[model samples]
Target: MRCETIREALSARIDGELEPIAPGALDRHMATCAECRSWYRRASSLHRTLAAQPEPPVPDLAADILRHLPPDAPLSSAS
Candidate 1:
């Protein structure tokens, strides 16, 4: 398989998406392709580090946004 195809499959594998490449084929390709192996290592490390962090709180901006709207403005302009 082409390196591009393998790299894409590696991304899907990392993201927990459906596995497209056969497991044996992927392992064999990675074993021989140093560049792909390096890329996968970095990408996997980033994925793990990001996944371990707690989600940041989402700010509630609805009230603040509504306050900025003009009083007479129509909510919807549909005829």
Candidate 2:
């Protein structure tokens, strides 16, 4: 794959949001491409750091979503 394609997919690839790529395509490209490799490394580190973080507790998640519905909802402090 080209470096442009790899650059576009890097974040989703690091997040594991994308379908698996042909295995060696990524390895071969990254081996020769310094910029893409550096970007992937940074993105991978960020993904790891975010994944390692403790998830924030969201009490009554459904209620929170419903309560924030537009039009009829009372203004939230954020507004």
Candidate 3:
């Protein structure tokens, strides 16, 4: 399997999405490919670190956005 294909599969697996390639296939490829093994480890570690962080609070902007909007005009009657 190509390294690109294996890398894509690795990312999908990390994201909990269904992997297109068989798990065994990926394992075999990574076993022989040192670069892929290193990439997978770094990607997995980054994913775990990011996932563990708490999301910052998002301020409600609806009211502020609506306040700057122009008022609606009545539609003219059509013949």
Candidate 4:
């Protein structure tokens, strides 16, 4: 696979959402492409870090509060 194509599909590849052929192509490219292998390592690290974070607890009133907010209003207290 071309480097551009592999780069484009990297995220989906890491997420296990790529088509079988795409991943196989990416893997083949990665085997011989240093740049792509570096990129894959970085992407994999980020994916693992994000996946490791605990899911935030959902507030019972969150939906009700969001429903009443103006469409253009800022959502955070700092805003």
Score each candidate by Cα lDDT.
Answer: 0.93, 0.76, 0.93, 0.81
lDDT of 4 at 2: 66
Regions of model 2 farther than 4 Å from truth: 17-21, 61-79
* Clashes, model 1: 0
Q: Rank the candidates by lDDT, best first.
A: 1, 3, 4, 2
The residue pairs in collision within model 4 are none
Clashes of each: 0, 0, 0, 0
lDDT of 1 by residue, 1-79 (tens): 8989999999999999976889789989999999999999999999999999999999999899889999997778898
lDDT of 1 at 71: 100
lDDT tens readout by residue for model 4, 1-79: 6677777788777887854455666677878999988998998999999999999987699789899989997887682
| TM-score winner | 3
* TM agreement with the true structure for every prediction: 0.68, 0.59, 0.74, 0.62
lDDT of 2 by residue, 10-57 (tens): 766776676356547777787899999898888888878989999998
- Let me know the TM-score candidate 2 reaches against the reference structure: 0.59
**Candidate 3 lDDT, tens digit per residue, 1-79?**
8999999999999999999999999999998999999999999999999999999999999788777767773344575
**Clashing residue pairs, backbone N/CA/C < 3 A, model 2:** none
Model 3: lDDT of residue 45: 100
Model 1: residues with Cα > 4 Å off, grouped in runs: 60-79
